[model samples]
Target: MKIKVIKRRGFEEPFSIEKLEKSITNALKCAGIGLEEAPKVISKVLEILESRMVKEEVHASEISDTIELVFIQKAIRNPLWLNAAKCYVLYRIYSDAGKVPAKFSKTDLSLSFNALKVLESRYLLRDPKTGRFTETPDDMFKRVAYAIAEAEKRYGASESKVREYARKFYEIMSELKFIPNSPTLMNAGTPLGQLSACFVVPVADDLNGIFEALKITALIQKTGGGVGADFSELRPKGDVIETTGGVSSGPVSFMKIFDMATEVIKEGGKRRGANMGIMHIWHPDIEEFIMSKCGPEEVLKNFNISVAAYDSFMEAVIKDKKWPLVNPRKCPEIKNALGKEVLDIAIKCSEKGVEVKWVNAKHLFDKIVMCAWKTGDPGLVFIDEINRHNPTPKLGKIRSTNPCVTGDTRILTANGWVPIAKLFEEAKRRGVIAGIVEKEREISKLGEEKGYETEILVPYGEKLIPTKAVVWKIGLKNVCRVIFKEGFELKATPEHRVKLKQGPWVKVSELKEGDKVETYGLWIKEATVERVERLGEHMVYDLSVPGYGCYISEGILSHNCGEVPALSWESCNLG
Candidate 1:
């Protein structure tokens, strides 16, 4: 056959049809395509090439694309033409792209052919009844594996290396087939791009602020963010209304809007939104707030409700004192009350049990603990603690923590508290200090008082004193000094002046006849000495040292020798 090669300035030289045919034959031979099929595939490609608008400078990429399209549409379905056509097209493209030629010299193509056969077996589908054809989902993976195996076999790649490549190809296929988490699988490659577990919104005092927050919350929830809000800032029920000249519904009434919002939002069009609603203890409608969580006419079952308690209220409970229930609107005075006034009201309430739904502080604490133990709901957060530790303490007091209290930044600016006390409690139980400042303070106090700094180690028991004297003598300096430093003025007791005139010590042998001694702030007559011996580092003197003494041991008297008398320590002066 005659051959013509074309060349143009600034372009790679192109070969004639005869030369292209020989090149295809060589590539097919290298890829192990049978000589019988190679010529037929090359002849068909030559026929298609004759119709192309021959350019002065021919780009191999353009030719490859055209050839691939032709093969896909015509030759791909025929098993006999498939491998040869693939080899010819791949060779032309690789030659143009400067990639390794798709040809084998000495290596056998059996492994590559077998790999392709496995792919075809798994991924080529035929209608069971009609015998029509279809490609299975695994077809793409199988094709990739077949291509890799063919390349490795032709290149004399190591068996281990070829197996490694095969394993990686399988892994890619497996991952493509596996299911992922909802957000990751849905939004990972999508445009909207919101992937989070929860969000918290703040309900402000004004209508614009409230509704705006609600709208944002709805938008977030619509995209699958669980939301919580603090409704405590809303004015109480029946409080003065400037806009409508009528009584305004309290936080509980407004909470219905949130509940309704949750119903409408629909998380990713799948589930209802979850929320937490909280109110402070000083709220005018706090009674309503507590009841809103329970009772037949409850408003928000979707929301977890909590009461924000301050430090003073918690302390009053610890002291078994009364606590006042002050309305934020009507009795705003009690909102920031402290010291004796708050304590007095609390105590009065405790006495009467009717001032404002009086319940024992411990009882309320137990209710909160028990409820959490049962349903894992109604979490508590120390509101004062939250505020004290808030980073932006200057902005405003934190009214509530978020639903989970995973953090506190939201609380400072959000004007709401959702009690995450259970979460905090859980963190504490795990020994993780969620509140760094609080934990530091506790550790500091413990560190300061760790050693021998005034500890009461003696167990409770009867004590005795000996040798009565006039007032103004017994060592009261240390006790008085401690009291004075503690900001307390000590009153003089009748026995404060009693003096230890002489010999507050007694020997084991010298203790005998009509002895009296003082031990543990009490005076007692001493009986006869029973026995004496050495115990470890100290001498054990068994003297009758103290009130109602009967066969007293030396160890007891010797260990307490600071208050023991001389010879008189042994005698029984029981009268």
Candidate 2:
């Protein structure tokens, strides 16, 4: 005869030996006891349950009592069983107590004690007169559900349909299957009604623009939103302010002002204010930005800073090349020398207007890695990689991310790209392939061609090697127009590696007017640079090939991402 176990609430269910075994095994594990003897101990406990089989239903407490009695008997042979018995009893007590809050003990929601405490303090509506919690956990879920579902009325939903949807929403929330963002949980139904968790504010390079962004940031944080801004537009430190007749203090100094404001304003007066500060790699004061929060003292405590590393900078780091830090104000004017056969942009910049500083890429990258290890302030944001997945190409470049990095852009996939604005949309989209991303988590493969099916020509030292496209990507990269004296032109990122006549890889930015680079058509041939100039921004695409880590782009040899060597090596002393 099958026996049923009667719960404390008077609900009866068939006794599950599997559940009993799992519970006893958990108790044993918690007490640091071996599980090898668990099955034997469980069998002894089951011997007692055999007597209760004559009854149609057995009280749940009786099963617990029998388990405790068996554990006590086992304690005579092994003292560790006593600890296991105590753990088993304590588990029962807490599990019972955790079912619901004291006032709503009969409610079906199974919330832990800590969860209830959090709800009472931050979520549960309180009585204005008494300042005591006026709503139970279930009531709190219901209030949020009803308020959100009521919006369906505006969308032509029927009253009965609205209630039904609200019931479903409440079911998901109360069961802990799904929880909305914090702002939605906190102020969705409240008067504040601000449901956004973060906002991106623009900061132009002027007095009015700076203060305007600051004011907007403060107001957003007041209503429970964090703020993020790219400070790359702001001129470098000591740049002349044409109107004020005083030199600008730079982006880092302005970041301090914003950080101070964030320190004073609590988000929604309930959460701490947060901000993300980003500066481009080409920004003249990038080193200063990287070291802003490097010390033991708390500096820019409210802000998280990141260097908007362009693909060129990363490529420079991997190839042990010099990375140029340029003034954004000078970029447009420098492009004016479009047809000039310039020796170097920095040398050309001096003739045009301002001088650019070139730092050893590996050394600078080491400083970034060290600073992140030291204070965890400065992190790298791959600007080129980010712009590649831009869905709205016509709407201009995406400058800043939200404080916690939420955006509805897109990702690279085979055949093209797909907008990642909605999860369901991405799922239904064709040409999306699976690949391993950071931390071994699988995501849509970033590609421009069918990875396994497509092959490309990769330059591998005096030979054009056929390589399969493992992955490919499409994005906006700062393209350098290199006109060869051999009557051909190639465009790619400044740091893109091309083969030199001496059989070494050299960056496009470092290639001089007379530098001879290798080219491929029927065979590898030498092409001397006639003119090297900045071609402004453009839609650029590249493929990731095996072995050589390079591909044939516009007849010139080009390297793929710089991640391979940078991630594998520990030494930064490579010349």
Candidate 3:
């Protein structure tokens, strides 16, 4: 059967059922739809168009819409057919507006196909990995483009100008891609609205407060945010319970609840929630807090531990003395206070040996350095440093930093690095015994002034800087520990190498390129030495330690080198 209609432009167009069927079949075949399904859809569409009893003014849009209705009713899911339906609908609309040519020429088909492919590829079925996609509804594309084009045409703009604007608009839209954070991506712009990276809640000494903190922490974890708590405010261990007259279990016991909470409250059902458990040095159960993260199997696998070192404790360590390990509840004055006076008490406690084991400051410092050297964690946050640099110091002393020891700007302005030594010195200058500087001086002298001989091996492109304080063993397999002015120490192993000035000198093994090394024992790690230079008789190894400071190490010659026992060479014969 054939149906012919003269277009309004006087061009006669003939439509054959067989031809329509063939076109539909080809489109469906290209779309990967089965012929059996495609024929039924095509037949329904052809029947509607053939039965058109309307005037010649009937638009192609109407015809395309009818076909689309049939396909939709048949539940057609073919991407190609869906795109073709949209393109047909758009063409019909354009034809009704007299914008399309009367005769459906090869040029028209080619233009429509190209336009449809671009639209579909840009909007439909986005690639999951690359996030790019194919065409969307042709009507929608035309609608948006037509609005812009019409505006430009109204302004008397040339077609080229309108097209250039359209291209620019599309380019902008293409780049406006957003990847939300874990929580926001999972929930936000969705039904569940919880979105946060970290949450901090108070845990009072009461049952309600304790459970409340745990519940909130659990909820935050459910939405995929880690939690940290300052357990210092909790009552001390062995404190008389007013409610039950029994001894309080203290912060350590309460921490177990949080530990259990972390164990059960999985983050979005994927992994256990991470937590940060902090206790002040003065807490009665401070020992448990410090040792919590130690041992073969840490009790809380998801928790990072930190001991909030107060001013006095640091002072005592500087003075090579003992520190007081008073419970926060007993020493309420130390709660949110920052200054040298508060530090004096900690120093006095250290002298009395009442605090957590008063060993050499060097020992504790060594342990921390070693752990950081190994695991890159167990971060130290000098409480005094945090409080001093805190912009809101007037509000209250910053009791805790973030889990990573990177201070939160909301509480402390200098969130990245806090100058503890400067603050301590300032406190002393004000006639406050904030720190035992004299004691720190003695310890520094004892460590840095000692005749420590270390032989270092340098690989290719490596050099050694000699320090007046350090005695270098210019030979192979030599090892020595570097004691800094502040009681910080590091061990360097040097390799034997021949140099111009010295007959044979041991070059400390320069860390491989890209390896992180630290200097001045200042808690900074991962600094790389950029270049090495010589200063007169001593070699200056120019080094850069990330986030802390840069320094140079120098070698010292032994006075007894000339009188050293001579090695007698003995010839051995192979028998």
Candidate 4:
């Protein structure tokens, strides 16, 4: 017998268990309920309701009430689940009453109205039954503070000491002194406590490696995280594939696979995830990679393309000399070539002859600048400068940075990584720097074949083995954008207003890369053009400032820069 549900209107519709499952799943995300377990919550609620009501027709309100009852009961025993239940109920009430709840527990913090809404939507415990906020801003602060502070307990801190740290954390937050990243704030103290905001997954050159990275990318985005990848390792277009005896499609073509996947996964229909696509300056397909995002419609919107330049490349540009572009497969570091060392490698391929092409350094640089002038993309990352500050030389070189966070975290390594936090606490008690080596030694003893990937702990007690192909694992803080704003479009071009101190002020339509510009955000700041792109009628420019990167379209340039005067900056993060 179909369970017919009466809607707020007079119409009747069949009840959908899938619909109920989705509701429960969304509510559980508020508390870190896994896919495997969240369905059980829905089954429990449905079971309870069916036992009480056997009628052929039931009001939607009655169904809503039964789910609420189940939520209330479960939440009481597992207090963390209360947050999920709260959101469910609140959303249900709003549905039935057609009004958002006005009464909320008051907190001492002085917050903007918009800020309060953000806290409610993203941070506060919600009525899981209704998908609404039930906890206040104060409640969120306490939860996050206590959760992060608990990490100190791993340091052998006494109970009193840990509690004091938690108190201090709460004080800082309540005073509006410090705030964690979105992941920390949203998942903290919850069962799904993934603290990192971004993941840099490696896309190995081979078929399985590429798909494996794609799989990891999907998993990360599903949890509302971003990813960064360097595709310089993949062979260029028209390269030979020995295994299939076919020509290779190259990195730019393969990127579409990741791009299409992103279009579908799209962070569970909430927000499409973002990616950083980087290509080395000397890669055989550097030109193709740079031009990949160039069409009128633009390809790969989910990605931020950048050229990974080394100091030597810039030196070649200054000297106006021919730079050698090497085939990625020919690097001397590649010891094993899947099978018997292929004789026709990049060094001296009998079929293709020498795999090196020399192009005017300045000419290549100009191409990057010109493309960037049209599209605010293919920015440059000075790899030499990045590796200079790396603390872990033993791990390997840093190739790219995550688009979701700022600065180089220097956690780059080959062949995946042992979960830091999962093994970190136990490792730290043993020692500090030496303990990491000790853990590596310990893991190594398990045999490379058998212990290649170890199941590691994640927030919310989820066990996962990190991807082996990844070369970088960035340390992340909550992005201010996700914390305060909701539903970010994937790589939407931003409109920027330009005010030049004493030059011709024009809209983005006329803006070009390498233009000196004045920027205003936190006070005022000086900025220079890294790249620019024309998306239809509007021109977008990527700005490089002191510490970070920012992009905007000339459409936002309300004031003419021809009349403004130059001055010092208060603060800025555009890169």
Best candidate according to lDDT: 2
Is 1 or 2 the stronger prediction by TM-score? 2
User: What are the TM-scores, per candidate, against the unseen true structure?
Assistant: 0.34, 0.49, 0.37, 0.51
* Model 3: ten consecutive residues of lowest lDDT: 566-575
Model 1 deviation from native, Cα RMSD in Å: 29.2
lDDT of each: 0.41, 0.62, 0.44, 0.53
Alpha carbon deviation, residue 506, candidate 1 (Å): 77
Estimate, for each residue in 1-575, the C-alpha lDDT of model 1 and write its tens digit.
22233332234554456565576566557545566754565566556655564644445444544444554455457654445545554443334334443352211222233333332333233334533223322333443444444457555678777777866764555455432233332233234455555555545455765786677678777765666566655677777777889888777888888888787777655456777666665455666666665555656766776666667767767877544554333332233233343444444434644235444566565555665565554566555555455554432222111010011101110122212222222323543111111111222111111111000111112432121010001111111100211121212211111111123444333443333332221133232333322222111111111211121111122222113221111111111
TM-score of 2: 0.49
Better of 1 and 4 by TM-score: 4
| Candidate 4 per-residue C-alpha lDDT over 1-575 given as tens digits, one digit per residue, 9 for 90 to 100 | 37888775558999888888876776666456566767677778777767777686778767766765776677667765666666665444343334444332334225543465465545565555655455556667888888988888765788888889999999888888898877677778878777766666656667876897798888878766777777766877888898989988899888998998998886523467788787777678888888888777668978888887766677778989777676656552211111112122323442445457778989989989998998887888765555465444443322211212122111111323222232323333432111011112222121111111111111111222222211111232222111101211111122223445345444433455555554322123435554453332211111111111222221122221111110001011112
Task: Please provide, for model 3 over 190-288, each residue's C-alpha lDDT reduced to its tens digit, 9 standing for 90 to 100.
Answer: 334555666555455567657866876787788777777767768777777777889888887788878887888787554578877666655656555
On TM-score, the candidate that comes out on top is: 4
**For each candidate, C-alpha RMSD in Å?**
29.2, 23.1, 23.7, 23.4
* Residue-level lDDT for 506 in candidate 4: 45
lDDT of 2 by residue, 64-126 (tens): 888878887888998777767766654544353343222232232266434654664565555
**Which portions of model 2 miss their true places by more than 4 Å?**
1-109, 126-131, 332-351, 391-575
The Cα error of candidate 3 at residue 496, in Å, is 69
